[model samples]
Target chain A: DAGVTQSPTHLIKTRGQQVTLRCSPKSGHDTVSWYQQALGQGPQFIFQYYEEEERQRGNFPDRFSGHQFPNYSSELNVNALLLGDSALYLCASSLRTGDLMGTEAFFGQGTRLTVV
Target chain B: DQQVKQNSPSLSVQEGRISILNCDYTNSMFDYFLWYKKYPAEGPTFLISISSIKDKNEDGRFTVFLNKSAKHLSLHIVPSQPGDSAVYFCAASVAGKSTFGDGTTLTVKP
Candidate 1:
């Protein structure tokens, strides 16, 4: 009955430092997507993964990359972090490989990242 | 530019009244619209959704209305309860890519 889970509830890093955040999707889910929510703004889609392959992605730079594991878990890697990178990193899971129309996505509590 | 826009940053209403939240999107490709309720320090939780094929969908006290012509959509909460007070975010999707609005904070006063 456990939902999506994320590691390091909160993280703080300095500029130029790299960070990797992890996520374990809810049981019976096969797809995982990452989103970045900046202060006072809605979440911006980062990318989505299905079957261990990156199926779809948003407008984020190559510096923002992700990986999906055989177990359906995911990790978002942001390199050369900037102060702008500071935001709430959210991981959502869906049952289907398609978009929101095909399945409902359940999101995790999110990892709050702060760049000093 | 913000493809999806929720103009109201915050709104307040009396308990047991109706709370209407509005959202507008610039992308015509967006066919699926959803409303997510989020609390402070937490990720948004899916509240309800309406597909382009359907103009309106209702469940219990929550309803979502879509107007393709207006490129707009709205979420109506009837008999609003105190628990309904939260930041409501509107999201639109096409394929696997989705866009969300800034959000509107709703406060239902008792």
Candidate 2:
């Protein structure tokens, strides 16, 4: 009954450095999605992974990429991170029912990434 | 351009009162609408949702009303409690991909 879990609860890095954030989706869930939430703003979608492949992506740049392991775990990689990248990175998991009808999405506590 | 918009940044209500949160969306293709609550340092948690086929859905003290023709939806909380004070986000989705609003912070004062 464990919900989605994210690792490295908080991290600080210099601009241009790379950071890798990890996430383990909730048990019984298969789809994983990443979101970024800046101070005082709502979460913004980044990308989604299903069946070990990226099924949908938002407006994020190429510097942001992710992978979904066979075990349903996920990793978000940001290359040459910019100061603007500093935000709370959230991971959400949901069961993908056929036809894409709305399914309940459970979220993790999120990894706070600070790019100085 | 944000497809979903929550114009109110914050709202305050006396305890035991009714709380209404409004959300508007520009995308007509969106078939589902949801509301999520978030506390500081935590991810947004699902609250309630409504689909295009239905105009209203209720769960306990929380209820959502959708007006498809106006492209607007609202969340109503009756007898608001202190625990309900948090930032609420309105989202619209298609094919499971959601577009979120700017979020509204609600404070239920005792």
Q: Name the runs in model 1 displaced over 4 angstroms.
A: A97-102
TM-score of 2: 0.98
lDDT tens string, model 2, A17-50? 9999999999989999999988877789999999
* Two-chain DockQ for each candidate model: 0.73, 0.79
Weakest lDDT window of 10 consecutive positions for candidate 1 chain B: B91-100
lDDT of each: 0.92, 0.93
- DockQ of the two-chain complex in candidate 2: 0.79
Where's the lowest-lDDT run of ten residues in candidate 1 chain A?
A: A96-105
- Write model 1 residue lDDT over A34-105, tens digit each, in one string: 999998999999999988999888999999999999999999999999999999999999888334443457
| Number of the top lDDT candidate | 2
Candidate 1's residue-wise lDDT over B15-110, tens digit each? Answer: 999999999999998878889999887778989988889999998999999999999999999999999999999999888667999999999999
